[model samples]
Target chain A: MTRLPGTAKTPGGLYAAPSLVWLSVFFLAPLAIIVAYSFLTPGALGGVEWSPTLDAYRAIANPTFGKVTVNTIIVAMGATAITMLIAIPCGYYMARSEHQNILLMLVMIPFWTNFLIRIYAWIAILGNEGFLNDLLLSLGLVDQSVRFLYNRGAVMLVLVYTYLPYAILPLYSTIDKFDFSLLEAARDLGASKMSAINRVLLPNIRGGVLTAFLFTFIPIFGAYAVPLLVGGTESYMLGNLIADELTKSRDWPLASAISMVITLVTTLGVLLLLRANGTSVLGGDDHEAAEPAGEADALGAAR
Target chain B: MEARKLIDISMNLPHCALRIEDGSDSVAGPVSATGNGLPRGRALQGGIMECGGAKKKTVKGSDVVIEHVRKSFGEFKALDDVSIDIRKGEFFSLLGPSGCGKTTLLRIIAGFEAPEGGSVLLDGQSVLPLPPDARRVNTVFQNYALFPHLSVFENVAFSLRLKRAPEAIVKARVSDYLALVELQAHASKKPSQLSGGQKQRVAIARALINEPSVLLLDEPLSALDAKLRQHMLIELDSIHDKIGITFIYVTHDQQEALSVSDRIAVMNSGAVLQIGTPQEIYEAPATDFVARFIGETNLYEADVTAVSGERVDLLTAEFGAIVVTATNPPPAGSRISWTIRPEKIRIGHTEPRAARDGINVVSGVVAEPIYSGFQSKFYVDTASGAQLKVIKQHADWSDEGPELAWKDDVWLSFSAEDAYIVEVRR
Candidate 1:
């Protein structure tokens, strides 16, 4: 019962070569370029004239970059945290329910109306005298209209509402395999509703939580539009900062440095979690390590 | 002779006064019993049987009583008017095919689903009013339902932690059950690390670790391979004896139910057909449904021509007038079903015994012998075209082997006692 190892050529290896070549060229080369760019020094002439140096990473320790990095992390982490808090239960409810057709339509409804347009729709929603403020004022809930636009709250709200689907989809996939009968076993074991939720439900979904977190978190660090339209100048994430560094300041070198840092940190996050569980928050496309053991195949197929 | 009997001096009367009273007719009208207040009970007008000293089994208590239980989802009836008694510490089974309401019955008993009509009782107390966690029964679900995120030890320790037992006792008890399941080495590893048999054992251990009065198992061994299932039968029997708790095991696997259950309630179309032991269920199923469901059986519709002593002749349209011993005779002129187990129909070389032996035997060509390694079954066809199955014993006929091949003329005989007669509507 010896299975043949793949050959160097033939229809059996039809898919492998193109995939390997494409991955090597597109994926590996870009990461290699980013790594090469990270260790290179920028010329005084204001373009990326490469001189091998660790000065770019050293420049990242500057106070301006540090503050922006911290701010970027704060915004990303906040949005990721908030989105997951909403999406995990949403995903769990969707997974453990029989209303899949309707729920899927609902989950896809946000997708049907365009992603960028969906964010713009939120601008209409959070406008000072828009639907929300007007409804609230007429209902006598607030004496005066509040500043709903150009704020951290607006950014957080749009972040959650916009990337909320991203957080939910990964979690939905994981929760689909969450062994719901295990929850029943817990309840049958005399675990109260809260105890079952905390002891049974939460731990099984931790992988989904981390996945959804990374799905929403890393993307939030690099978001350009949502915070721009929603939060304005105060909530300048690294994506906006990179855009400004490249466009407004005409500083391609610094912009590349920021992009390199973004790529590096995302890789670290992916690597750390993938090292722990062998699957990424975003489906790991680049790992050349041994595949996750055959057990996951049986489990995934069973699910 | 061991020690002379000594009466203690503390037997002196300590009571001061003797009081006697009579109960007045201050009793209110019938209390709201089953939520809707359906008038129930036959009380002695105004009699109150106080529980002081002498215990009454009839009036006082019962275990795992499901009465007038009906449950539905939308328009589909999952359980309808299902009522049964599960005695204390008995290994009872709710056995049926898929969608026949066996698991639903188990769930209703576990308080997972509330029945529409009647109530569920555990130890004379209604559990229908309680949530699943409040009930004194725990369920081991199909696929074991062991926590994949937790180790075997944590899975068993889970209920103890939920009950907030002391750390030392929880550890000791969890270890004891881990040993009981024979997975002490795999205690620290998660469920993903364990095999299917080990997982099911852990699930059973987890359910029983709470020491609930009743344990509900919903096809817990259906996930295992055939060999594992056979192995689990012995393991489950031993565990049942050791735990001494009422196990209400629900499964569609008939052999599993027959092998493990002390009593089985065969359900079909949301109703119990019969409740009996495995042997009783197989050898003498009360209904056609139960008989056919419990094992391989042959059924034929016929009219009883004569009811003689321990034998009757049935005139079947397809098989002509066939005679079989009647353990219980129907009316002389009545349409009845003749059910005979496949193995009970003896296929022999000689002519089957006639009048004195109580019945006529069908003579047919051996249409085919389906060989499945262990046993060769005979599909005999009478000239009248009724195909009857008979399991030819491999052990006896092996030495005289290969004689009963295809197209060999054979006589299938059986005692009238082996055949059962039931009223046939069509």
Candidate 2:
């Protein structure tokens, strides 16, 4: 059947019905509920009350909440930085390697196991009497079993492991689509091998790097199970704070407010990522963003 | 023209410094360190000098000497015992069909591929051990691999940035090179936004900004349409003239090689069949494959019947007899092959005159006449069943359509000097 020209704003919107319905029902509705509850008063027992109040937002400004926010940002940023450092080389290798299918399969194999099960597996490997401690004892490397579990480092480690694949996949796709001859061109133009990768390959694949960063950082920012399973007393995060607010303190409005904060931060990050990647995805950009502050530096030199 | 003047003035100082440095024979400079013995900084500084028009016209370019370069990919021989000495500042070409080792040779020279056993020298200095980055050479890749993320200005300014030149110098040089390529208006545009021809110009400008001694072009015009390819070819030639650097171009298109190259090396099946100028390749091809590949021609295998002073008579199975002129005539009773171009043979409607001293005439019936607007090509079947192709040009208005129709009795005559012996079968 032919469609009327002006009736539908987007003719392809009909094909997008499944995703639209799924997001509205499962995502947007819950998000709207959380936003509404965040601005209301908490009931005496658990649920939010009908009376409107700003107590939940006022609680977020406290010093204890400020510490948790700082801790969460540190864990997310540190883990994301380490994951990207490893994933860049891995993605480059997979993109250029002849055995791409095998490498891709290996990258995806971790997702086959349950998330909590994998965190428990890390515990088994890193515990005081675990396989690593046993091996260290047998090798006479340590006089006593090392306490490798229940620390902030452990939480960051598990977070990195959980989100490594999310970072690798996008980086791999972008590196694979890159024209490798540009590297050769860079080399032919007197660039060192390292310089070629930094100046040409990295800038060209900026879209993938941004996507990988968002993919890992957003998930690691809202991480719950890994930190709960592997972390010690000092490793409390926004996700655990929200969980405690809802379950232990019986504060529904505070939990919704915390959740709203996480969602707002992540949404801002995603918007920023989309803006950076919109032109790059189409293989066109102003390219002035990546340039060094040469003019400013020159002016400084002049002075 | 302003770009040329700027290049000349900027190129002079670096060149004088290079000459003094070369005299000192210092091959251990930090900037020039390579596995190769010679200092690359000296060569790169030498490259800068070659970009100057007036000074370089006297100083000349580098001599590329390839000595017995051999390469193999698994069981397939990509380049086999190939060697050529390219002159300074020459526009040389490696002409061949697909998979004929032309590109392989160009890659070896560019330092992208290492030969199994050989050495390449630039101006009497070994460059085989130098990496692509160390070698004083650049390539205009076949696909025009302009950096997609970079604007036209940044792409051309890449080498300058690597050298950490002053920002003002970088901008000025980039603008000059862009003006040299007639792409000043597109300086801020990214490579993806440019058309195929425009991208090609960007690639050229980017490569030329480095001022390498030898510029290697691997079929740089193959991506463009016919009319655009021709236009770009002219532009490339003019660029070569303005720069006066050694150019080693690789292409499978015979017309492009013939029209642009100062000398051409015709290759086939990983072997160099012949090396000559366009006229020599077209008129006196070394072998049957060369004859067929260069242009349209009628080739026949015949047994030599007699040999005289600069003249040889031969008898073929299809055609009864034929006479041709050869410098070193083959002995009588030997099998040989010869070729004559279609345009060289004259076709007439009626018998005109007696056969001259060097003219060989034969009578045939027109089999197929293809009238392409400017010229007419006729395939004539002789009485003995041999077909000879002849072309007639329509120079005036009166010679418009087919002057002679199908099955018309026509006389085809060509001078003995027009035919040349291509092969002598043992």
Candidate 3:
């Protein structure tokens, strides 16, 4: 068949060729190397050798590594949960507000500052004799400065603060597209204001919620800088473990293996979340998921 | 604002005063079964006082009395002291052009928009303090607004679910309402999957499943095509008949209001110009705006040359002297406005020889003839250089290519009763 230029029968793949090639060169190739290294022996000089072994995977089963994995999961989940809790209301207000441009700019203003500098700014406020401690001392609220930084809580706080805009932007866009008239319909149908928002508004914007969760959770799962700068020994997470193995211990295979585990955990978490919500990851169109109706149906009957 | 109120009061005073003068014996009518003092009188000439035929059930609906309701947004007054007494089980319409505050009044009644001043009462109890959900009023929004995330069955069952009804009851009631709107088969489908008419039906089912005391429909059929609009109107009327709940319908379409409403409140510029039956609104409009808004009419300003017994002689600026009927004729030599419907003016090639008793005839040449299938409209330019529109119905086979083409010499005539005083211009 004689085909015109740019009109091939299966031109979708051809159109995607650039991204495919780029991903292969820059992303997938690195990922493949990491996977290969995870299965290979670690060389003496901080690199993988030709001999293959399951030594790195066996090291991951150590209680120390296990403790870091669990700690990382807890921090990631907590930070994401808190970020979403703050983001949802901010998104709703921005979406419904008349000064949406200003609110959006305010939400995005944090991004203009460098991420590390912003983290440092948080440390300056939360450190011993920081702004908060100085204020407390001036107000005579405390006799001594509180040790607010260098802990798991500090890592979570910084992670949440950093990732909040990521959650808010997707949420705001989805909510702005939502038909607000449905909320009125819900109220007209005898639902109080709160119930209307919960049943109608939340379910309708669940796609945005999922997007916000993944956006916050996945990044916080692999958060390196926040933990490194704000966290103490008790707050050493998976990101810190991978960094320690790669740089200090020079266990290249172990670092690659831990990176693979983080990737696996995130992918599996995303898949489970999508399945639980009965939504396809690619088909996260706002109206595609109708699974929440089950809870509404049950509630209707119960009510 | 003070001057506007004075003008409003002066305009509405005559409507009630004239009805009292007619000796219809219902000026202060007995309270309806629903206990609302709705003044169920034939308030204007040609106003139909009786309710619709046989299908009407007992009054299970709430009486909505919106009194002196005023609201504004920034500098724009959306509703200016708008007051309407919607009777129980009445298919009442708030008819006006866009931005005339008909939808705003409906929203006020639905508890969606709070008024700056005034009280809205349901069954003689003030409902203004109650939230929309606490009030027994449900609205079928303009765009349907069916929850996109919910299936048709769940959408219909939403209210019952909120009340925590039994599972079987919710199921049965949802099915019944879905059947009422004829979407029982599509209950499992999402609202996005439905056609415009079907989506509208789902919205109707959703709102009506609650069995609200009053149903507020805000331009519900406006999104549908012409044919579907007509069909949905009929379906809406039937549903109203079956339910017998008070329906406060808001629309810009006059024909829809005229065909469906037992009473219509015609509004303009955020104020109600007139309120009466469709016949009263069409034949005996209280203002020049109502005459122009309700339907097509030939409206003109004229000097009242003489007035005697029910016949008023008016001298037009161009068409010369014309005689019209008015029960309350104004003083002689005062400038006034008058209107005659296009269909009321008969056009013929020669002089009208039938009845000259109360008929006024004017000779003119056809200026513009617009021929639609069912009727033809002719803009006739008189010998004195005034234009008049005459609509001739093509109800028979002989009307198939009218003999009177454009620029044809024609004579137009109408009985004095057909041409009524629109307003006495100040």
Q: What is the TM-score of each candidate against the true structure?
A: 0.76, 0.86, 0.88
Give the least accurate 10-residue stretch of model 3 chain B, judged by summed lDDT: B35-44
- Model 3 residue runs over 4 Å out of place are A1-14, A279-303, B1-56, B395-402
Give per-residue lDDT, candidate 3, residue A18: 76
Alpha carbon lDDT of residue A135, candidate 1? 92
Per-residue error (Å), model 2, residue B22: 14
- Residue A25 error, candidate 3, Å: 1.7
Please say which candidate is ahead in TM-score: 1 or 2. 2
* lDDT digits (tens) for residues A1-303 of candidate 2: 223454357757666667777888898889889999999998888998899999999999999899999999999999999999999999999999999999999999999999889989999999998899999999999999998888899999898888999999999999999999889888888888999999999988998998899899998899888889899778888899999999999899999999988988889988977876775555543433222223232122211
lDDT of 1 by residue, B1-426 (tens): 111011011111122111112222122334223222111121222343221221111111125888888988888898889889886656788899999999889888887777889988887788888888988888888878887666677788888888788866666667666666777777676677788888898888888777777888899889899999988877886566455557888999898888677678999989888887676677767777887788799987889888778678888876677776656677777887878889887787767545345455778989888987878898888888878889966756444334578899887777667777754554
Task: Give the lDDT of residue B117 in candidate 1.
Answer: 91
TM-score of 2: 0.86
- Top candidate on TM-score is 3
Worst window of 10 by summed lDDT in candidate 2 chain A: A294-303
Which candidate order results from sorting by TM-score in descending order?
3, 2, 1
* DockQ of each candidate, alpha-carbon based: 0.24, 0.29, 0.33
For model 1 chain A, give the 10-residue run with minimal summed lDDT.
A294-303
Runs of candidate 2 with Cα error greater than 4 angstroms are A1-19, A276-303, B1-59, B352-354, B395-402
What local lDDT does model 3 show for residue B316?
91
Clashing pairs in 2: none
Give me the candidate number with maximum DockQ: 3
